[model samples]
Target: MRWNRIKRRNVLETGYDCLNGIPLISLRYAIIVAEVLNFHHAANVLGTTQSSVSTRIKGLENALGVLLFERRHRGVRLTEIGRHFVAEVSASIAQIDHAVRTAGAAIDGMEGHLSIGLHSPITAGFLADLRRQYRASYPMIKQSVLESRSSETIALVRGGQLDLAFVVGTVNASDCHSRLLWREPIVAALPLDHPLAKREAITWLDLAGETFLVQHGGTGPQVFERVIRRISERERVPRVHRCDVARDTLMGLVAAGDGITLTTETTTHVPFPGVVFRLIADESESARFSAVWSPHNRNPALLNMLDLATQMSGAASFMETSNT
Candidate 1:
């Protein structure tokens, strides 16, 4: 029996039957065959001979001890197991490609200092992988994070002091160019013992008698403002309470039964002893997160970061990069 080795993104593949068995080509061939349903057509798509595809597939089936496809006169039909297997293999290929891009970009890229500002740790959690990938791709480019209020982060971007900022809501600045990355539903944080915590979803009116806590100078105020605007009749709006402390402290208040607060889905990751995060019944209470930067700021590393972000986000801004 002949053997082969394929290396991609640190994932090593050896021969059809080795210490670590399974060939990359076998998985690729299986997916193509499942998609085309004809060995000859799949071979054309894979840029290989029909017999070669057949041989690899037979080896794959033998290794797995199951028939992936039923042979037919003109074509083939995938087994129930084959359909699920192909879907998983396709996802694996996507991750491999991401790893390749992350590795390749870090190698041949510009080196510079980058200052990033963020309002919440949730934003950091979402970009954690991207940041690691960026660091790997631009090892020499020093990067640091400055956790501050959204207002300050926006100002820093306007002043060109910060290269990138992940902010909540839309940014209104002539010098700053912003792109919406995602919209997450603003959920209400209530004490585990609170009456409303028992409900699956809470409404605006449900909060009429509740004390609404807003994080002073942070994105929490803007989210609250929108919640107020969403209410048509303001006959009895909840009295807003301002918290000058940090997010964790404010959540501590909720847990202490001092008051209830509203925040984004990212806060769910934050575990407080007595706080429960519940989704808002109204979809209009969604919070928008955006990436903001000064157009005039000329940083090669920042440009590279934006390109990767654009590709990852799949936003219309991606078109702008293509044009440039």
Candidate 2:
């Protein structure tokens, strides 16, 4: 990140007699001083002598006509005004870093950083493999993976906040490109002691009287609720227990005999004891995974991540077919 000090000062110099023998200096010097908060460290980072940094900072305060930092016995601390100035300056620095990286990528015929917005299920599976391989091949390109709900992720991609996203369900943003990754069928997870655990497959009606555990995230609970309503036609939907807050937590809860939960086949390798996964007998329900990217951002790093996702999906499909 690059730190930018305000180019134009807001200080109005009303009197030439206001100087109390303090010297003047640049905003760049003030920025370096604010960042390190220590005269020595700031001097080291700026490749200057500590005494020089101190002298320059004193000069900056003289010019600004306000104390930016409170000089402590050891190091320093920002005054309230200094804190606000630092916040804005730090953000500007980040933007400057991005601008520099973008320019460098252009010269080198590549793209800079790639930020991926992913839903919980996609983050757990397809994206995991993609991240590993993509980083290995393109170590120079930085990657950011954010996990959020499908709706929110889609909105981010549409607004240009995210470079790309892996989402569940359909992505309707016209400003971005989306590719189908896989279709996952929902399944029921039952405790080993449950009678339905022994069945080859269980239908929605089999859960009519059972206590259902709903995994909360994305639209998993909503989709499952719709499935339950269709099969169990009650005036009030069953108050299903919500046990797990995250994907892994939900799996742990399912294995602990909390209650039966619904999930996809892609999720496996549960560690807890006495848990059995049963395929849903019904075929009417399914969820689709997709890769969404902004059409405007031609970032090669983002495109490379998408390529990795495509490769992972292909490998998964081949594995499925071979197993079948």
Candidate 3:
């Protein structure tokens, strides 16, 4: 009768529209009652009074305009329509619960997506170790990496295209928050039989006049500038060749004795046949790497990653101090 009254006032409304008006609490009560087949038992499980549970079920049945349960002297049983309704509602409630849990995990930085931009090779070193630890700690968070030039990575961070960027030098962008994570000593990549390869370490003077090969992308320009600054001061002005190629390809050319190139200590971990790596003994030969991100970006996963990096950087500094 109540349904008839509501239906009369809204003649064009669909059945789904009417169902939408029913409160979730009443639907849940109906589901519980159907599960236990007794109002008193369902009330006990729900931590409520039997009369309250019975009233909610009665209201839910009236809203549907059908008897959902057949009451007996001892308990109750579901009608055919009631069985179908309960099954559907149970599945929907399960989905709602899952959604709530997923949202909460994302908020807590335990699950979500993280996009990182970097110019450095993560084959070995702090960045590589950091990635491994982050994946272990937040296995549910999806990670993507973009390797580009330092300038491009910084631009991506400011535009909100990347959650974080690690680059080879201190970032001084007003729109970005930056932190110096670590410095890697510069190393020279040389053909194994080259005269300088036998040295434990080499100096800028040692490389002065040697033909230097650098790639056009990634840290190539930076290496070229450093080579010029360090070698040109003596007025010996080295012969530098800029090649359009990948880092690995440049290393191959170095192996073939095309020329020598500069790299950070982390890259020395990867072995190139016919090539050897030697550290530059000059104090200024190390490259300082910094992490950059936009201050306005509020991705929880990004925050978590930054926190982890800070911890790892601090630990590494402490270890270095102890060793010295």
Candidate of highest lDDT: 3
Candidate 3 matches the true fold with a TM-score of 0.86
The local distance difference test score of model 3 is 0.82
Clashing pairs in 1: 106-137
Would you estimate the TM-scores of all the predictions? Answer: 0.60, 0.52, 0.86
Ranked by TM-score, top first: 3, 1, 2
Q: If both were scored by lDDT, which would come out higher, candidate 1 or candidate 3? A: 3
Q: For residues 111-178, what per-residue lDDT tens digits would candidate 2 score against the true structure?
A: 56778887554334555666777778877777787888777777888788888877676555556677
Expressed as tens digits, the lDDT of each residue in 16-129 for candidate 1 is: 433247786687678778878999998897678999999989998998888899999999999988877777777766776766765555554555578999877643445665
**Candidate 1 residue runs with Cα over 4 Å from true position:** 1-110, 122-125, 231-235, 317-324
Write one digit per residue (lDDT tens) for candidate 3, span 157-198: 989999999988776666788887888888999999999999
Q: Model 1 — TM-score against the truth?
A: 0.60
Query: Alpha carbon lDDT of residue 70, candidate 3?
Result: 92
Model 3: CA > 4 A from native: 1-19, 233-235, 315-324
lDDT of 1 at 125: 49
- What's the distance in Å from true for residue 180, model 3? 0.8
Tell me, by TM-score, which candidate is best: 3
